[model samples]
Target: MKHLLTLSISIFFITLFPSYSQDQSDNDFKEEVKRIEQLTIKSIKLRQQINPEAEQEALNDEIKTLDATLLKKVTLFLNEYGWKSKKEIGELANMGLFLAIQHSSTEEMESFKDIIERAYEADKIEENSYALYIDRLKVRNDLPQIFGTQYYFDEKSASLRFNEIEDFKNVNKRRKKVGLAKIEKYAKQNNIALD
Candidate 1:
């Protein structure tokens, strides 16, 4: 019985967290990430109305298609390579990886979280990216986030506001540990009311 139980638990973990293989070269990884970044940037620019309102529907559809493609690529990359350190893939590629994950569906966002944490464990995830990812998840789950990296418009204040924070008083300390700006500065930059 004990052996059976242990086996089941081991299989569960193995299924959820597949082993990583570094079969792809650093240059290849960088190039692929750049490709994903190009798609993401195009989608973002379209959303920002770089073109005309007449093109909005077609462009939004393009963004959706591009997002799906990027998500597939990102899932494959993560399953094979896991999350590489910034030292391994450079800052841009590292950020590119986060961008691909960030734009994924909420389920995908939650699913790839452990994979992304590999970079965080190595202390090499890019600046503020990890914080933002975590905060995004927390807010989505209706929980208080640690870092003030995710915000929404609060109707009460009639302005953008950081989501509720865990240990509000110590949030800056946590942010500092994770390479995020102080809560005050971040709030100010986002035009959120500290009061």
Candidate 2:
């Protein structure tokens, strides 16, 4: 009788957990592990094989974009801590990046290290601050930018709702109207992009 009761309990559990039985299959788990391992290896290889020059160029573009938007928010952040330009903010970003090392994936840690090393080469920032700032940015990805082009900053609301979004209707109403005067003056002065 005891044996029959135990057999019934085993049958009930098996039926209750069909997915678990399949999950425990050796081939299924091995394939999953193999795929994850391949991805991790590829990320590591890319991090190691990329040249600093290519990375620097990318970072320059990023800084330019950030200048138009993120730089303002970062400026506010630095002001709270007392800082000025991108060069100074880079040091602050480094400090955040360093703290992020503890929670980062191996590939992320490598990139953080690369950023610090590159900053050192450029003589723009100290290693300690570089580490810290990067980490802070990673954690604050959700924060809205308070600076940059006033147009974008004006659209941000603490909460967005159907009616509240209408607040953006005139967000750019007061934005500086760029025209021939500015464009021509800028282009002729720089000898660059033309219309």
Candidate 3:
């Protein structure tokens, strides 16, 4: 009787929690893709409306709330499931992740570097996008930027230009390698004449 009871319990456990198959993983990933897509769209819209100088404290508060919530969700998803292939979630969701990372603390950003690097190597994210992130991290650390994304306009001299770069001489070569436009062209677009 005891042996029969043990057998029944083992069978019940197997029936309740079957082994996960590849197809099951794929389906689960697909569902996650949909969820991330929705979150990305809402977050992007909120981000665009944020203006610190304007009297929109309510909107700013909403952005902070969403950022906190989305950051937690994104971190958890990345940790548990890892990055979904580009084909699964597409560019929009990736863009949303980038924005979330941008709003995160320096420590969080550093922690996500491995995942982001893997995605870049797998061609999930574009080279230009990768360069932007690298440059942002450099700026955060007070190191010279490699890709020249962060810039400021000199009010006295009336020029728009990047901050200090690591290697000023080879900047264009590095920029070209990463799919960024030439510095002169970028300056012109921003209506600043390069000296």
Highest lDDT model number: 3
Error of 2 at 25 (Å): 4.8
* Model 2 C-alpha lDDT per residue in residues 35-62, reported as the tens digit of each score: 3334333334444553432336664554
Candidate 1 structure lDDT: 0.75
- After TM-score superposition, the amount by which residue 155's alpha carbon in candidate 3 deviates from its true location, in angstroms, is 7.4
Sort all candidates by lDDT, best to worst: 3, 1, 2
lDDT of 3 at 166: 80
Off by over 4 Å in 3: 1-27, 50-56, 152-161, 190-195
Task: Between candidates 1 and 2, name the one with more favorable lDDT.
Answer: 1
Stretches of candidate 1 off by over 4 Å are: 1-31, 43-63, 155-157
Better of 2 and 3 by lDDT: 3
Write model 3 residue lDDT over 85-162, tens digit each, in one string: 556568777776777787777888898899999988988778888898898888889899997777766666756667
Best by TM-score: 3
Clashing pairs in 3: none
RMSD to the hidden true structure, all candidates: 12.0, 20.4, 4.0
Worst 10 residues of 1 by lDDT: 17-26
